[model samples]
Target: DGSGFLAIFIIGMFVGNQNTRKVSYILPVGEGITWLAQISLFLMLGLLVSPHNMVHYVVPGTIVAVVMTFLARPAAVLLCLLPMYFRRYSIKDLLFMSFVGLRGSVPIVLAMYPVMDDISNAQLYFNMAFVVVIFSLLVQGACILPVAKFFNVYAPASVAPISKANVGIMLNDDFDLFNYKIKRDSMEGRRLRTLQFPKETAVVAMFRDGHLMKPQGGTQLKKDDILSVIGVESDEIALNAIFSQDKPVKQYPLYAGDKIYDGHTPMTLLAETYNFELTSFEKTLTVAECMSYHLGGFPQPGDFMNLINARLVVVSLEGDYIAKVGLYLLSEIRLKEHRRKNARSGVSTLSKYGQKSLHR
Candidate 1:
């Protein structure tokens, strides 16, 4: 416990890796503490610096900033990540990682020591440190995304889970808060008392037209209304079945060459056919319309949509509408299982269909 910072780091890692219950409980408190610390640190550092005095050392400060940004930081990153050694990381990845070594409030905070001790070149060093921090925050920080994209390290688009509930409250680790928009026509216009949610799950709060109301048995739900409920994880599927507009596709009787749709199917059918549980927003829209809605206009070939548990690429287009959709399931275990099952049965199923078509 010589350094409180090191002790905190160790404790954080221990709790994060080993104690799921403790982690969930402490996460809110830890976040508040972290934000308060960050704000206080920046405020103290700002009060300690003098902008007019910094201008006098601008030349030397800028030179140091250039060296740190281009050489020193990159060298440190490459050396530390040397274990990657061309196996997993390529040159572009290394370069991008190096470019992102941003200096923050910590370095500026450290620089305050020299000024307090009245050491030689103290003011100049402080000024240079301040300059480097600004350069990192303003310049390097801004370019981080673009640079990552250039190196192909950026993640693809997907349905983002903004928050689990209207107000995330973990009561005793026995239940989790799940936020859902009332989408299914069946659930809309129904009273909370009549719907009969699971015994363990309870709707804690409801948001209607941007207003938060504590839900009671008499509360009636409508489309676009958001409900934050606390429930056990195992009961989630049952809850989703009620509130979600999307229905699970029956895996039974699905065979190769089987047409899922004989006529026009909603674009969202791609989700059901591919075994994806659609997000509340993904229901009802045709594939073409969904694409256009998401992409800001008509989606062309190569445009992709990321749903909660699935990824879709527009494989083909028929005049401004999506004709063929390619689904990429995000779960590795599920993907392998599906592939194995389909490959085993696909050959026989296709042969039967092919024989009938040939005879005709």
Candidate 2:
């Protein structure tokens, strides 16, 4: 009752949530202490149990371990997670969790309490607990990675930096310094400028074979090179996508002169990035869908639509679907005139060039 474990757990939860910055400073020290404590715990447990005594209980302990691993643990996981089925928990996730119910040092330590209190057959309990722990480690632990793989509950490999240093400055919360090691061969022969990173993201420093070098736009990326990048926090996803080999990178097209977007580009992204207006319902549509809707569901190359102050002209098509669109902003005088004519007409109309007016 007075073990202080519950108290420590409560304090840890409180501090972790309330003071994350302070907690980060102590993480390295806490990890070192945790490793030391685990080593000491196993050593102490090893000193208490004799291999001769453990041998007598091995058969029964193995049976108990099997039952727990195959039946009891799985049933318990199913019952607890069944209410969350489909919404938050999936069948494969539940199955994997049930299979990986590894018994740890806590049970062995609890077993010692019964023996110390002089309970009936406490030595039997201690020996059984020891055998169960050993069985769980040797059998269940060994098979965990294979089971996880079989369930497809694994993340693709990513290269983490060898070192990180936080740079403290004004408005630091909005920005971050990321150091990534280029481990994949996909980016090995590509130049830095060709990678199409996010606008606010830049690679500032590069190190090859332990020698620091300045990174230029034309510098080619090589495997095992460590690069220090500085970018805003929102650019993290785009940066990760650029570095990832297995995942497809989402394209972030610019709104500069003569730039065209693929048909698949989201209209909502365009509106938000370029200050274009869109209705709540229209926000869910893509550029191709909007253009096709304006053109009466049959769009061809060079067909244009007048959307607010910009003209969206279909540039190309992949079969019947619009594949590319070029955007051109109207002059201030033309935009005012277009709006005045729409207000006076009080009806949706099509122009001579087959351009639909979406003003109303």
- Candidate No. with top lDDT: 2
- Misplaced by over 4 Å in model 1 are 84-94, 165-177, 180-360
Which residue pairs clash within candidate 2? Answer: none
Q: List RMSD in Å for every model shown.
A: 17.2, 15.9
Q: Which candidate leads the pack in TM-score? A: 2
Candidate 1 residue pairs in clash (backbone atoms < 3 Å): 267-286, 267-287
Residue 331 miss distance in model 2 (angstroms): 24
In candidate 1, what are the lDDT values of residues 155-214, reduced to their tens digit? 644222235532234433456678887766666556554454676776666787786655
| Model 2 agreement with the true structure over 1-360: per-residue lDDT tens digits | 575988887887776554233454666687898799778878877887888787788889899988887788778877777777769878899888877754667877788888789999898888888877877888888888888899999766555444544444433243567888887777765556457667666677777778666554334567888879887556666667677774433433322225688999999988876676776777788999977765553454445666555777777789778898888777778767755654443322233222423444
Instruction: Give the lowest summed-lDDT range of ten residues in model 2.
Output: 345-354
lDDT of 2 at 44: 75
Model 2 lDDT at residue 163: 56
Model 2, position 313, has a per-residue lDDT of 71
